[model samples]
Target: MIVVVEGISAAGKTTWCHQNAAQFLIKESYPEKRPDRQAGPGEAARIWTDWNAKRWSDAVAMERAQGVAVCDTDPLKLHFIWAMWQIGEVAESHWTAQLKFTRQALQDQRLGFADHYLFKKIDPDVAQAQKDHDAARSRPNFDLHLRLHASLVVWYETIEKVLSGRLNWELSETLPAAEHTPNPYRYDVSVFDRFIQMLPRPRR
Candidate 1:
């Protein structure tokens, strides 16, 4: 199974995935893309074009090996991030089409990317790091800022919908604080132990 573990940038997903590697083949949605790049002109489009191709190939190979792939991110969030950054309208037909393409690709590859939902959660440190990085950059483009905010909004909504509908598999965590409070490291010792206990039995 391709278990995709995603959350806001600093949501401890990396740590969680590493600890549970025996149960999953962890990966980020688009690992090849550079975060420091300026998001403007044709950069986003070009990146997506390359991303889709390589991602499809990588996914197919992983599935063929019957590997338990746990991706850190998925193309869904990447495109959503881009759409938020540049297009400004996720509901637009073109954006919808791109999202559908991603969905279809996952299905075609038989790489089941599990959407583990965590709602109303954003890692404060991660957000701050991004903001600081952007500010320090010699020429931070405006489009990137747009996408950053948009991606955050979309991330919250996307997780909320998944949780509400129970579309993906469920993994519970003991939130350190209320939804509004900042719980960057929400998955502490107790939550981590719970996650470990819930790991699926290995496939034959």
Candidate 2:
């Protein structure tokens, strides 16, 4: 089974991943040169879609070897663009482009939903305290992450409707166990559409 741990910055995802799934963890990553704000959403979403697809592939391969593979973030990260748009930090075009590319990737089997997810929640004050005490990592977007916190819940809640029993709202004290079931929606576009349809329609 593939397990994804998703949360805002400084929410102990890395700490939990390293502690629990160290040998089979696929950590979150950023592009070497993230596109600038001036870049069109078309090109930017394609690049990001590929990055997330690669992570999904890695998780699939690792799960074959170890029974469990842990991802620091959801590989199907279209929620990012939507969440950014919800915060008014990006144009709706970005979310649309990302949704298109991400849905296509799902249809192509380049990315798929995980077998389980830990949508860990954290208080803003607790996150700030963690950021202050941890000198090693700098969360320059801590404020932005805090802003996205509520919006992210909506994102995951929408996912739970499509995925049903596969998600846990909190991280477990120990690695949660999941059995490997034949994933019918691993490459199903209808499942992708259902997930999107559950959310508010994107800008026309």
Instruction: Write down the RMSD of all candidates, one decimal each.
Output: 13.4, 1.9
Give TM-scores for every candidate, taking all chains together and pairing residue i with residue i.
0.45, 0.94
Candidate 2, 90-142: lDDT as tens digits: 88788888888898898889999888889988999998999899999988888
lDDT comparing candidate 2 with the true structure: 0.86
lDDT tens readout by residue for model 1, 24-97: 44365454555323334234444564575465456446645754444555533443434353444433344434
Top-scoring candidate (lDDT): 2
Give the whole-model CA lDDT for all candidates, comma-separated.
0.42, 0.86
